[model samples]
Target: MKTAMLNKYFNTPHESGLGKTLYQFNGLLVLTFFILTFLVWGGTGYSAGIMLLLSPLALFVKDRPLQITKEHYLIILAFSLMFVAHASAIYRGNSAAEITDLDQPMRFILIIPIFLYLKKVGFNQTWFWLGIYLAGLICGWQSIAYTAGEYGTRVSGPFNPIIWGDIGLVFCLVIGVKIHHLIKNKPQTLIPKYIELSTAAISLIAASIGVILSGSRGAWLTVILLALLFLTIAFVTLPKRISLAFTSVMIICSVLAYAYIPTVNVRINQVINELSSFELTSSNRSSTGLRLQMWYTSIIAFQESPIIGLGKSGLTELEKRLVNEDKINNWVVTESSQQHSDLFDMLAKSGALGVLILIFFYYSTMKAGSALIPPYSSTIVMTTLAYIGFGLTNTIFIGMNGTMFFLVFTVFTIVAGEREVTSK
Candidate 1:
């Protein structure tokens, strides 16, 4: 009876009650962390996220900390390849300017405290799901607010629509899981079920609209892939009727978004045009053509130093080579140095070995996140899939938002969900 009472209301980090209060209140700390992570706008989220680590650090100091294991070291080593790839390039005289960019990814190490804290006390799924709901809600509103404006095709908040759309895609997966869970569990409470079911519906509709309005082709592609993945997983484990219904809903959602949303059609037209009339010469540099044109340089740079590639700062050499060959547009060369695609960027900066490390890291992340309950494992896999799809066309690691999203969630899964069930 005493133990039950204690477990209900108290979280004792140490034997004495002196530090129990702090540990008891750690849930609030975790709530704050999740809030910061989900609200990836401006620099505020990242800043607050880093500061929130103090709570866990304090608890870890007061309570018994986790012992470092070989698995943990290996995971860290996999992550190390990310930073080391850049350093190796710099070592090989890639670019001295990469220092500023290097610092951005280093902040991803904050995932350590985040993982440790959540691992000790488990994550607040209620709050986390709520954040996902709110994100979808906000992005949906933003889409409506931006529609009919000049930027209607790329409806967004502070960040680009691509980021907004990609995150919304992940939220859609969350929404899908929530809806599935509600139905799968056969909730008995009519009132609660209706309320939750309504919330889930609204979240899905809004996130779907947000994705369409954002006009992010990468996100659009991933949405289709994730939807198919969800359906396939369901088909294997769920009733045939349920799987068929899910498949129908996904198809309907895509069709409605494409047909009713003006931005979706616009993006499709742009893609069609870009592909149909792609020209690699300096005379024309379409969006698709520009990406291809830039890729020309990346391919050349990779071939030259296929081992590690051109190093971190190898862009200088690449641009110079582009000028000599005249294979790339002067406009693209002058406008941005980014290869745009993460695949090519990895090849250009780190070479084939870096790409292999990245592939292994992603595979390991999914491996660690496998076999957890609904929304946990599925969420990890689907979100990872979204990023992978997005990375094919964009530079995910070069930016702060993508880097944080990937590391924080990946670490959380490995330490908490994948390694063990939530510690009671």
Candidate 2:
């Protein structure tokens, strides 16, 4: 009787409990940390910095598991080296010239530690997935609203125009998979089933609409890639009946999307027309000509400094000179623009060393991803492949939201590999 009373007293909220208090606070800390991450990117330095500072709470909790793997080390090495490369730019006398330039590399010091700590805590995979989906939904809704009256044209929401659409599309793909899973396992109870179906249906429609309104050809290409990946995975892993049902659903969705969504139809037609009429040397074509010019300049910059390459300072100087000489328009000039391509940008900024590190990183990740089997492996592989495909045309590492998304996904991939090994 005394022991029972003691147990009840200890567990009570008013009690100065040890384990209970710690558990409750730890849960709160985790929730707050994720919320901060979602809101604190995109130049929110104070908020981001505070979140990073608070991340150590996860590390401080006793008995918290750490799940670092060889794959994690390789991925961390790649990003760390890139951060070092950016910091090296400071030595080139660029640090004092541009506040924005200094901010990115300086901020890296803070971000790296936060990610390290998060990994140390064995952060919940489900929370990470939920965060991705929620971020996507918010961004997609805003994007659709922004482009509604723009006459079949798409505009970025809060993100920069060039890659916002791509980010949104990737988010949609992730969410779509989650929704499919929910639908597949929906409860037999009518109320729960209706709730699940209605929510999934609404989100699916919203995401599709957002993709169409964005009018990003690159994103459209990515969507196609996603479809192919999904079909391949479903066919290989699912029962024949389930696979056929999914295929039918996808086809119906596609048909309905094209027939009922005006923005989608118009955007599809636009993509077709652009591809059919594309030219290698068309100064009048904004997208193609601008990308070519950026590539040309980036190559020239790389040629000049093949070893360490021109740091941020050199790129800035080149942009200024190009602008003065009318070699390129000012709108194409980014604050920290290199080649829009991730690989080429590495070459331009960190020279051969950066390229080699990135190559090693991606190869290691792909190897790790390939080792896993079935649904999880397929999901990670497809998502990683999509990022790679998108990275060919867009540099994601420097962008605020893109970089965070990349880091989060990379961590999850490593965790997934760890889980697979443990399960075996």
Candidate 3:
């Protein structure tokens, strides 16, 4: 009788009262972190809340044995390489400031403790998905509110429009996946299921609308590529009729958006115009033209230093030199900071070794995801794909917001997926 009372008082048989309180607090922090990620300026800073709670546990919690897996190691490797590659560049005199540029990569390393802490505490699926739902909901409304005009103007958050668009697109896909999982697993009569489904549907539509409003051409390409890949996966994993119907709906929506949305129409026409007019010799530097020129410049830099490539500042120095030599346009030197593409930027700045590290990181992550069960594995893989798609056009790791979004969620998904496996 005394034991039973004590257990009740403590909240759980396995944890002390304080432990239970901290665990619940961590759950709240998790949910809040996700919601604030897209809603406010410097919202990504909320990750510090989680890090504060987890970091102490990571350092002092010595009673329990941590079941660290190979997947965990791979995840760590992926993060660690971010630091190693950049540090090497600084050491090789590619960039100045030994510790300044290293801060972003160091953020990845700092996330390792949070990863272990979450693995120790286990995951709350409801908190995660519900947070995602609210994030997309608020992000959609905020993006719409930021809109000044309609046709040519873009909707941006506190960050770049491209970053906002890509993040919104990923949220839309994630919510779609959540809805699909609910449909497949939950009973139809459950009121909570319907509520979740309805909110997620609204989130999906609003986020998609926000992505369109951002006028990010890279995000549009990501949509096309991912849509095709996901439709193929749906055909393989879902009923044939369901896959066909979904594809049909997507196609109809795309056609309707192109025909009816003036922004989409104008953006598409702009890309076409830029492509036709762009020339390596001509000074026709539209947005697309600039990207093309920067890519060409990156290639030239890579050719000059194929082995180790130029260090962090090497690309900038080379661009100046090219301008002086009249080998490339002076516009490129003035307009661009780094190569817009992630791979090319690394190749130009860090060389083949850097590119190899990046590829290995992606490969390890995808392989780790592939080892997991259905829906959880699918979520990680989809998130990774979203990053890859966005990185094709933008330097995702260069910005704090983009880096935080990828690292925080990637670690969360991996740990959550592992919890699901262990729970079974």
Candidate 4:
């Protein structure tokens, strides 16, 4: 019965209103995202993503009364909580700069309507993943250039490798889905298995190399952790032969990377050295040290006003505290002022309420795509987890790049999973 309703909602064509325009506009939004994601950089792409929200806005407000429904309520509620947090901060007289943080989660404002529209008309993962794949390929090309030039650290063309790593991780997941389909002989491709497999393999290899080349230890750790979890799941539930093959392939890849990739070796060694040299008291003065200092001060800020924390003012307060503690060197304050970690950024900036909304936002989004099936599910879930992991060591929600990537996928994922209860 439920499937029948879903079928009808999805299959029925728009005969009146701007439904057709709005529906087609959805595809255009994705196409724009793809084009911009691959070819563009800086604030422009993220800005365009935010601007793309206007298409749906016009649909809801311009042509007809906005259709509010139970189907959209989850997304609505999730987004509303984010707004409430931002609004609450502003109502109480927070810095206007604090509002910029809203761009992070606020990027998903159209999930509800977009999901409904997509459910009605359906979307093709083929096109979606293709966009993602092409974007990753661009990153791969730049990575080769970066390495060939002997550029130290990681390989990111224009953006931070952390952000680049985020892109690569999603592409690799897309490759996983594509490869699975190829293996299933899904008849989606006319190309021979060897050719298809080779392309997919190159893409995967390139994406993984790009991630490692970015030298984002955080991303590297997250990918490794995810791999272990996936392997365990495969071994426990998947066919024995398949599991064995996967395990063997993963082991080979890891071994080869660790042995052959100089950057990989350097990063691992750096992690070891950093951990070994870490000191809490008075700070150690390194990349890891900076994070520790920032984290400690953020905790202090959170403790000071657990209910309604310091907001951007916390940065000032943090500086004062660090100054008083004699930890306020030029560098320490420089990094701390930026709120390097998303955990503290949320805690210190919006306090506990911000954190709650954040939790709700991610939870709802992961489940938002609950209506999407199979490979689509994999993409959404992995992307969410990757962002969460990246957020741990970096201010993922603070940066435009990180937030923009998150926004694109969260909306995509929810729409893919959309299960709107339509007319009977």
> What is the lDDT, from 0 to 100, of the residue 243 in candidate 1?
92
Model 1: CA > 4 A from native: 1-40, 51-74, 121-123, 147-151, 186-191, 227-255, 283-285, 412-424
Q: Can you give the lDDT of residue 82 in candidate 3?
A: 78
lDDT of 4 by residue, 205-284 (tens): 77876787777778877777788888899989999999999989988988898888888888777767887887655446
- Writing each residue's lDDT as its tens digit, candidate 1 over 1-424 gives 6675345444343443434444445444434544453344643245336435554554644444454555565556667677777556555673355456556656545555555554554432444555566666766877678654444557745566777677777778768877887888876332368887898889888888778777888888876676777788999999999899988888887788678877887888888988888766655756777788767777888888887888656665676667667666676666444677888887887789878877876776666557555557767777777888888888777776667667765654444344333222
Which segments of model 2 are wrong by more than 4 Å?
A: 1-51, 89-100, 106-109, 122-140, 148-152, 179-201, 226-285, 316-336, 363-379, 412-424
Distance from true location, Cα of 40 in model 3, Å: 2.0
For candidate 3, lDDT tens digit of each residue in 1-424?
Answer: 6675444333321244444455456667768877887777657658654664566654444433467778779878888987787666655664356556667667777887787776665445556676888888877788778864445457856777788888888788788877888889864232467777898899898888778888877888888889898798999999999999998999898899899987688889898999988776566667787788788888887898987778766777888887787666778878655678888878887788889888887777787787665566877778788888887888887777777787777776776566332211
Better of 3 and 4 by TM-score: 3
lDDT of 3: 0.74
Better of 1 and 2 by lDDT: 1
Q: What TM-score fits each model?
A: 0.82, 0.69, 0.88, 0.78
Error of 4 at 112 (Å): 6.9
Q: Distance from true position, residue 408, model 3, in Å? A: 0.2
List per-prediction Cα lDDT, in the order shown: 0.66, 0.58, 0.74, 0.64
lDDT of 2 by residue, 306-374 (tens): 887777678768766776777766644653465677777777777787777667656655665665533
Which scores greater on TM-score, model 2 or model 3? 3
- In model 3, what lDDT does residue 324 have? 80
Top model number, TM-score: 3
Worst 10 residues of 3 by lDDT: 5-14
lDDT (0-100) at residue 114 of candidate 3? 80
* Candidate 1 global lDDT: 0.66
Report the CA-based lDDT of candidate 4 relative to the real structure.
0.64
